[model samples]
Every structure is written in C-alpha cells, then in structure tokens.
Target: MTTPVLFIHGLCLHASSWDPWIQLFRDAGYDPHAPGWPGDGATVEASRQHPDAIGDHGIDDVVEHFAGVIDRLPSPPILIGHSFGGMIAQKLLGQDRALAAIAIDAAQIKGVLPVPLSALRATLPVFRNPANLHRAVSLTAEQFRFAFANTVSEQESDELHERWTIPAPGKPLFEAATANFDPHSPAKVATDNQTRGPLLLIASGKDHTVPESVTRATLKQYRHSEAVTDLVTFPDRAHSLTIDSGWREVADTCLTWLKQQSL
Candidate 1:
C-alpha cells in the first residue's frame, strides 16, 4: 500500500523543520503532512515569554489530536516523528494505530532505558531552575553547536539555529527527566513489537541527545518485532538529520526501507 506520511516535529521545532522531507515524500508518491503542537503557531520569540501555551499539553493530547487528523486523512498514514515527536509516535503504537512508523532521534519511552547524561546536559539550563518552567531558556550559538549541531559546521549550525531554533516546553523536559518509565508513569505507553506496525529507528551519526547506544537500548523493548525491526545510522549527521544538508540521503534511506517491506 502507498501509505501517507505524517511528520511530527520535535521539541523547540515547528512543522517547518521537515521542509526538506516534505517534497521528498511527495515526490516518492507518498503524501506528507506536518502539524504543530498546540499554541506553536507563534514565532520562537513569542513562545519564550509565554511557554504555558504548550506547557500543559501532554502526550495523549498529541496522540488524540493526531488520531483525529488520521481519521480524516485519505488513509491510515505512516508515522515519522523526531525526539519528543517520537515519544508521541510510541504512544500511538500502544493504541495499535498507523500502517508503519519511523522514529528519528527519539526520546526514551517506558520499558526503555534513559541514558540521561546527554539529554540532561542538553537540558540542564532549563531544568536547573524551577523559575524557568514558564520561560524559554536561551541557548547560545556555541551551546547549540555542542548539543545539537556538532556534526554540522558552524556556518550551517548558525543558519539552522537562526532558521529553526525555538522555545520549547519546559514541563515535558522536567517530566521526562524524572518520570519513572514504569507501568504507572503517565508518559509510559505499552508498545510491543506487535502492536506497532513495522518500526524503524533512525539515528544520527553524531546525535548527542539520542546516542547510538541509547537507540540500541530501545531495541530490547520490542524483541517480538525483531523480524521487522530495523535501524540505520547516518555517521556524518547530527540530531536534525531530517533537515540537515544530507537529509535527502536520510529520506531516501527511509524510502528504501519502506519499499523493502510489505506494509
């Protein structure tokens, strides 16, 4: 089946982040759609002052919101999500929805381990102060380069920062940091290899937030789907692999992976 694709962006990024992948999916004859988190329509500067707009939003809220979109779509689309968006995708799989899913730069889900060193380092400024809960924490160009743009050069990093960096919800960061990924954790979603459709994990070659080891750790959670579970890493890329300079290769890899499967 020719499955439609929905691109769920990560924290601090808007739907615009997937601009590179939009046409690629369309050209491949797969429909691509991008939707923002509620209250994300505002520009980055505005969100910095009023983080509450998206602060109260939860994973289930996102899942149901997207489910409504899927319900109205031409078909049960394939899910393509990044970081926090990947968390959203994992929750959807618990519901046993969608045709297939690709989680790019995903955060840890319940039953999966959290190698929080990188993530905590990246998010320390935000969580270190409770007062920052309702505000946007400014990340310097250097900080952004280290946390997110390491693989990409300074020029590209500055450009990407200018073009894509935005205020994100602090609440989710705090919750993910401490939320015990247990059966009772509100963020926990019970997705085995079976409930989720053909699942693929895309890792950036130099992604600091979600390292290769962290991604590999996620594999153990869905051993039942080992028959179909797949992984590919772009060694020269960073966390924003979906929109980086070599993003076409990333998109093509997903396309190639999709074509090989019978979904």
Candidate 2:
C-alpha cells in the first residue's frame, strides 16, 4: 500500500493551496491529503468572504486538529508542511507521529532565536493590531507580495494573491512570537527526541517570512538529535516556493529526496 502524506499550509491560506503538490505527490505514488485549518472555509472565496470561520484559533488548536487527521490514517504519515504547518510537522515528529517529515519554509518553534528583520516586517499586519490577536487577519496584495511572492513576477504574484490568499487566525502568530516567555506555550517542539523520524528542512533563499538564516538556526537546534536531520536551500526561491510557477521544480526536488530515503 502507498504511504499516506499530509500537506499542511501556512497561515492565511487554505488547503487548496497544495493542489499542485497533491497531484505531484499522487503521481509519485504517495497517497497525499491536504487538510485545512480548523473552521477554514471550503474554498478561498468562502474564506475571504467569511473570515470568522478561522478566527481565534491558536497553535494548540491547530496541532490537535491535525493530530486527529493523522490518527485516522492507516499508518503514521510522511508529514509535509509549509510555514506554520511546517512547525506542526516538527511537533508531530517529536510525538513520534510520523514516519518521516518535510518542512518547507516552516515557521520557527520555541528555541529558534535571532528573529530576522524581514520576518518581523512580514508580521507587522498582525502585530500592529492588538485586536488581531483575537481575530482573523487578512493580507492585502501588497503585503502578500512582499512576504510570499517578492521573487515572482508581479502578474503571477497578483494572481496568487487573488486565488490562494485568505484570512488567518492571528492567535498562532501571537503564541509563536511570545513562546519563549510562555511556559505553557504550544510553540515548543522536542527537537532532541531520538524516536523522531528523519526530518528535512527546506529553506527558501528569498523568503521574507522564514529566511535561510532562520532555517539554519532551526537546524542547529536539532544538532544533538540522533535522528537524521537535513537542510536543503533553494537559493533563488521565495516563501511561495511551493506554489509559484516553479512549484514543479520544488515538488520534484522533494520527491527525489524522499525516494533517496526509500520512503
């Protein structure tokens, strides 16, 4: 039987953002599934029209929600996640819930320090609005372009914004940002769990949200782990590496890596 794969999207985007990736992995003979955030609208248009559907959710809610999906699978999945979803993949791996994992341009967990200026700028929309902590936040085309599609063409960026962008709960962002000080935070991940399966951290060179530097720092945090941990850097890609016109290239790269692992 083919091993199941779960594709998790980052904030402000729905599961459909992984449509191309799902098709690519399916063709590669993996049973791929992409589940949306809790209460997410069924489509981008619906999400944009009704932001409250995804409002007020925090990291724990999302982690538990995805865990339920994982539990229903026939076997522990090969987890693949982007942005905040990437962080959840790491958390699940720590819990011994995945066979192997791939995190692409993933958000940082508790121990990752040295927040980059670009990353901070990208969060300004949510951070600047204190009320956003309890509400969903939507990105304008300009903000989306600056954060995820800066390296793509303007036309493509606009199209991406129109097709995939939606409101995201700001609670997760707040939780992640203040994790270091929150003893009960859900943003923490056990990087040293020897039981954790192999993990591949993919970094986009031009990503303003999760920079290569941030990825390198995240990789360093797991140096003491006995499990196999790897980092792959795409020097020309941005945060939207998984969805841009060059998405097939990223998908092929991940497929090739997984094949090498015999996954």
Off by over 4 Å in 2: none
lDDT tens digits, residues 111-194, model 2? 888799999999999999899998999999999999999999999999999999999999999999998888878999989998
Q: Which candidate leads the pack in TM-score?
A: 2
Alpha-carbon TM-score of each model against the true structure = 0.89, 0.98
- lDDT of all the models against the reference? 0.74, 0.92
- Evaluated against the true structure, the overall lDDT of model 2 is 0.92
- Please, what's the RMSD in Å of model 1? 2.4
Q: Write the per-residue lDDT of candidate 1 for residues 138-188, one digit (tens) a residue.
A: 567777777788887889988877777776767566566555644456467
Model 1 lDDT on a 0 to 1 scale: 0.74
